[model samples]
Target chain A: MDKIKCECGHVNPEGTVLCEACGKPIEGNQHIDGNDKKTLLNMRYEGSARRSKTYTNSIVDKIWSFFSSVKVGVWLIVIALIASALGTIYPQAEYIPPEAVSRDPAVFYEATYGITGKIYYQLGLHELYGSWWYMILLALIGVSLVICSLDRYIPLRRALKIQKPKRHETFIKRQRFFSETEHVTTDEIHSVKEKLQQQRYKITEENGHILAEKGRFSRWGPYVNHIGLIIILIAALLRQTPLLFLDEYVWVREGEQTVIPGTDGEYYIENKKFIFETYSEEDGEIYKEALEKQEAMVPKNYQTNAVIYKKKGETVAGADPELEVVKEAEIRMNEPAKIGNGFTLYQAGYQLNEFHTMSFKVHRTDDQNEKALGTFTVDMNNPKHEYELDNGLTVKIDQYYPEYELDDGEPRSISKFPRNPAFVFLIYPPNETKPEVSFVGIGKNIDPTNENEYKLGIVDFDMRHVSGLTVRKDYTLPIFILGALIFMIGVIQGMYWQHRRIWIHPKGNGVLLAAHTNKNWHALKQNIEKAIANTSIKIVEDQQELDKDVSKRGGES
Target chain B: MSLEQRKANKAHKMKKRFIFRSIILILMLAAIVYALVANFNKDKSIYRAGDQAPDFKLEQINANNELESIQLSELKGKGVMLNFWATYCKPCEAEMPFMEKLYPEYKEKGIEIVAVNLDVNTLVVDRFIDKYDLTFPILPDHKEQVMDLYKVGKLPSTFFIDENGVIVDKVDGALTLENLEKQFQKILPKK
Candidate 1:
């Protein structure tokens, strides 16, 4: 390496702008970029020789400089922020119905939200966070964070570690705060050192030169913050792994058990009961006005008494497996039940008034008394084909429709659930060889032959409520929490403290006193003034003000 | 230290840090890119036409009200028409007669229609079969597991699988008699 030999018998690297051992500016170094000799020195990075500032020849150098530039990092952040805002103009793909997206997203977007939505969908903004360009933007920011921190941190640490408390007239003169004291005694210097020590500054002395330093660890704040940000970004990316994250939903009816989705059949949840309530005027006086004005009942609560079970044996397809009870809890809105294996079940929705069981009575058509010959109850979930009653009367279900409807003059069921049950019954009376056929439904009964002797009448029925639960498992939550904690610590450490240093150099029967701080120059000046109180040393003045005055005078000349 | 030695030491340290950071960066990017590519390549959540139909086993109420299970893998060699429906879906009722009509004729040609009933009540499904006089197999998805597995957003969703177990076509709504017959002919197994 080519070296620059300074007048103080110290050598510096070829690209070094200032001597490292002694703070003397090396003039006429074309590779180094800084303020002119007239103004205060740009001590942002301690006048250190950074690689980004010195090298721009190779491709690697260019890439390194590109990422290490704070300007580039800020621009990347701004672009990412704007893109994230644009994503919120419409719901993301996850918020959209999965079936609609799977069937055809383009059609759904256009039909639902018009032309702008069509354009958004076409640009792949529907899945903005997951889009390739967005991911690339995030990756670029991560690269910038890594490169920028490394570029500045290493050189600054080196500069501070090798710093000396010695004579450098120009360095002292260019400091933001500088002062000269005439005929200062050794006792005064000793008193100043004692005052600084009382203020918790570490004092170092060399050849009657003293340097008081405090809060040097605050210089590492930005680097620590960058590290935390990188960890958070990595945690966000890990969510894409299926093993670390899962979200699914299941519907469990009252008195029924369902294998929780996304558990690979290891967990089962049963809904013991579901309770849903709506606010009425009688409940409270506060909601009476709102309820009356809205003319709608507002839901107050949704709770599900649920039991979680763990599969104890091997799962066989199409067969019920043995289960062991794990825990039972009442899952309510915003109060999810935590099952084992990082799974949590949340009450999502409920279906009320679902048919449970229905009963019917067989009656004589000609009797005015409406006396029933036989009565039978049908379980909506599982009905019998035959029902025997007293006096040798029998009623047989020839056909059944759980949710009955008329299609082309024929009776049919729209669904398997007993929403509107209907049945064809063949009734047999004692001492009769021929059977009478009767069609029965919720509110309708018809005899096609019109010669039936027996009729079926509606009796009573039972209803149930079905509860919907969402199962979620997120393993990256702890990583995010850890990253946020580190970030907070870094922010507080960096913002709430300043790294201050004051250098005292003996100069011709007096001392040239100069001080510098990374931030809050006013506070550093006040500290120095207080420490030298009652001594012969005068108050320090900001030399930047003197520089301005000189420039104004030179302009007039 | 001499300026020459200090510069050499810094350069060596810089090279080491660069290599270490580069390795970490490359590994992270590789994992992210791999995940993105893999997610784009195969979305197994919703099946489409030309994909292999996912196999499942479900129990159904037989004529004698016995619990019997049927596995889709056992019917791999036969042409399968898998229909997902609920008892309350009206469109499903409109299409059942067409399915029943084609089942007898297509059974001789190695095409079988399997209706999956997404109902909580077994009696409702049994009564539905009796009403339509459906001769085809009826499998009740009691927990609606098969319904979710097929990603059937709408009722009367059907998949026509050829003899090789690959889905030839997928229909999301009620099919007309002609459309149903055409779908049956498409999945007819070769003699």
Candidate 2:
């Protein structure tokens, strides 16, 4: 190949096998007989270089290069996979409150995932998806999609559009399939060219020789593949929608109607029937093993329904969706109801709760003082409630589980629901010099150690059973859908397109032809060769005879 | 074709190929990023079994020596037992002696217990500890950090954890001695 001035004006960087500076092919090209070869990026880069204008190599440029280079693109994928996995290994390092996450946090951090995991959490790697570095990595991939596609698209299109060459001699000779055949007559060569053309192959003939080719899309598939990828990437970028999750549990008792708490306005959640289903005994055994493994829960179903109310007077909520309680709905494991603002109401967990008031009294032990610590109601869900006794003591009804279970080994629930609700009570005494708090189980009250002023007595106790339900709404579902769609499309386009090429050279005896294909070459070459072989009108005895006839015909023409 | 012309033609064609092949890689990356950003602002719902418990910043009479309060943020990505207790509470007092016994042996293995004291009587609180032979760190919660945040209306509410510190469950009232020991084993591997 002779040195050609690449549009880059850099002499195509001399034997540049490929244009590193401008990204255009610089040698071994058989398509360009004229000057129309430079791509958009090449022309621009060349123009800037020629003007000697100060071009600040911007971040976009680095990103452009990074994305275009297969090496860089591969690196980004590696980084993302590793980072995403790391994120799974650690926590986000953020939370709701101190008491909410009460635990020995320091030792916990040091033990798992190790020092590195902790560092990753601090660096926000635990929450790597939205971090600046992660986005940049993704953006680099996006740019790569553009640059890589641009690099290949223009050239592939130009190559596809290339007209038949003046002669296919050198090109055919360079192919792995070229063969010298001499037994053909001049008439036979003409017939071969005619046959190729009849078979829908594009051909160019010179003197007594012929060149034929077919199925050029295969050659351009990768370039097309690149464009598809870019479109996919752009689609992905468009898909970047940061989500806001509302993960609070709200009470929706079997009979009451309530609104789901989230930024996307209130939703009418009516309890048509809060029902629970259990696994069959046999299936439970099979799934019990699965449950022990913590595999997905063997779910039966947790169903509910309620009147959807736009307002207190808005046609009565769940009883009619449009104007009142409408329909009965059932929710189960792996099944959730889509509510509002990309929210899904899932049946995460349940509790056997209760609602009851406990009666107690406090009398002064000291003859000098008289005070009465009275009774109160401790709502299980709302534990902060308390009663102030006349004697200046505050009693908060802390935790109360109607069906309580001990944390020992067996996981057994209290046999009866509301018949016996367990209570955790915390008592506070008012003292200017020093305040004191005491914890007591509902039936196990201990009097003040002062052993002088006051003693609390339990007069009466009551319990009722209720169901505890957990609510959840996460917003990443749509992105998952979109990603699935893109992957399928890309794979189909990449896997199905086949590339086929043929080169035919005219020589003295007849036409010398060769065929090659990038993919599906096995079947394609066989068919094209068969077609060409059949097209030869007649065969001369030998090379000597074929040459004699071809030269004589040349003279006559 | 002249060598120069041939080179130009090849350059033109190669550019197209480069562009095409790389697009797939780019799209894959974009898809991953999009998925991530989509989930970013949503609640992580991170507190789970095998997840680290979240750390908190706390003020204790002793942390003053370090001139800094406790930091709860660091505790996540590990397992721990964060119990909120008050001085006068019987259950809280009953649980301390047990926690004190298990803490030393399990602390190195990964188990941690933060006894947040919401004692009405700080003076009486000291005597209660001395009365039961307690050894674990008792963090005073005068600010009610644990109370207001955890919505703790009950005393001796202990949060259990697995290897990763995410709170697995919250226990109210005094755990039976056998139960506390079993839980300590569950949260921490044998040292």
Candidate 3:
């Protein structure tokens, strides 16, 4: 029994191809066994342990090897995919349910979906994306990717970086493509070098031997892609942190100002105007209409002329604070406007304001006779002001209800449209502390018991639109975008590029050339043939010759 | 080293690697199981029953028709009925009279009703208040801050907060006089 001492002073077994401590090839220690030859050709870091142990004495070592396993990585990915697909079976919690349902999710689910809903609730699939298990799955995958890449990358990089121009006979012989020529001249070697250089191969020559390599960066492609994926996963997790991502919907009526939610009143947006249009055919009929009425008019475009403002003064108690206009922009569907450094405003939807204008008649009525005192027009757009009548009476427009209705004996506005317009008016006689209240509809009125004092009637009314804008602010957007770009680059590099290497050694006035590639053996063979096209170098593609040569060498040794 | 010794060393290394890998796999699986169990018992909502309500400030119309700001934190020791409603919502209109009817009786018991109006139109809110003769604090959530905070997907949502600022119950629809009384009883401070 004998132990071989490496140049680095580390003693390894005699049969070892490399120094176990430093991952360096142990020269002149040739066992030239079948397994040794396979290790030379395929194993990048020959000195390092190739397979994980079945049992470990220490707990930490056991854990380390678990994460380092490619099998674990694949299993994690498969499980995560299955869980994600299962999540899609029922809509995520964030998406709005299709119908008007109960606020109690359990009750709503049970009522709507029955047994499936029960299962969905019991399994906690309603908020699957944000669920702890899903988070753990992502975390495990991230750990797996990190461990798997680290385990292989360091050794591969070391092996690739310290590659030699001349290789062992066993190593050269084991190559998929090999060639030996007799009576080779220096001129032929020069021509081959020139052809390889022309083909963009980086060449290194030492001691009458040449090593040409290309697409070395492709070797790092998988690791780079893994890094990008890890970054994307981290960014996704970061998005869950408060203030990193904020998605809020704000409904702004035209000419109305409101503070943006989640901005802490730091920003305010006012809707100057909302414009809505529909597509019409040459026949002057709205496209996608049902019968004579417009059932579902194909929306042409919608835009909201919004003015963004920054809070100027400290909001004093009981006082309206001043806001300075930062930017004025028209936000349309698909076109988002950036507000400050964080927020982006997008036009999401619109609601039509049906009550445009209300024409009212002030009537003075007695028990015997009723006469119209005066006619007045109240603009629905600005329905906050009071109008003074000529009969020493003040008519203050309190509320304008479009599509007014009485539900369960309670007065309410059904919709934004002016299908049934109503108005609540407060009539002050002269200097009364409390004004008389009256509810007036288009053709009816909730008349006061004392109709002799004053009566109001709504003559006519008209309609207009308001836009719904979605304000979004995500700090992790840049990180997510960068990760996506890097991932694409990594994928392209890994899948499209092939790492190829060739070794050329002068064997007693003749040359022996050997070539190997991580992928695309046919392409590497073609490249080699093209490199030595002008020379008299004939390639030995037959495996039998290589085997015979290796056996003879072994016999001689 | 002898061939037998070298083989033994290799076997030992393989054993170590296997144990290491197995440990990591087991730990990850354990973590997944823990997360699943924890998730099953967790309440996802920010404002759920038995949880302390997040405080907010809103502009409320006072007795003089002037806009005055009111903060929920100021009424910490008093029972608070935090209601999220829009003027357009029918159930909200239906429930206002009942709320107004109970306000006087509850006010004597140190109970405060903070009705948050989600409508952008101030005039509509003012008129609705005047029409209903509601004496309770009518807070106008012009930006719908309180609405968004409570995650009010539907209108007329009411949260009954006890004197300790803890949410006792959350009712989603319009409440009648009887329902309001029952909810108020739960939130009313123990005397």
List DockQ, one per candidate, in order.
0.30, 0.05, 0.21
Which candidate achieves the best DockQ against the true structure? 1
Candidate 2: where is the Cα deviation over 4 Å?
A1-63, A88-124, A163-168, A186-215, A218-253, A256-258, A274-303, A311-403, A407-490, A534-557, B1-191
| Higher-ranked by lDDT: 2 or 3 | 3
The whole-model lDDT of each prediction reads: 0.79, 0.50, 0.72
Chain A TM-scores of each predicted structure, in the order given, are: 0.71, 0.55, 0.67
lDDT of 2: 0.50
Per-residue lDDT of A40-91 in model 2, one digit per residue for the tens? 1112111111100111144433444455555666787788788778767656
- Rank by TM-score, highest first: 1, 3, 2
Candidate 3 chain B, run of 10 with poorest lDDT: B37-46
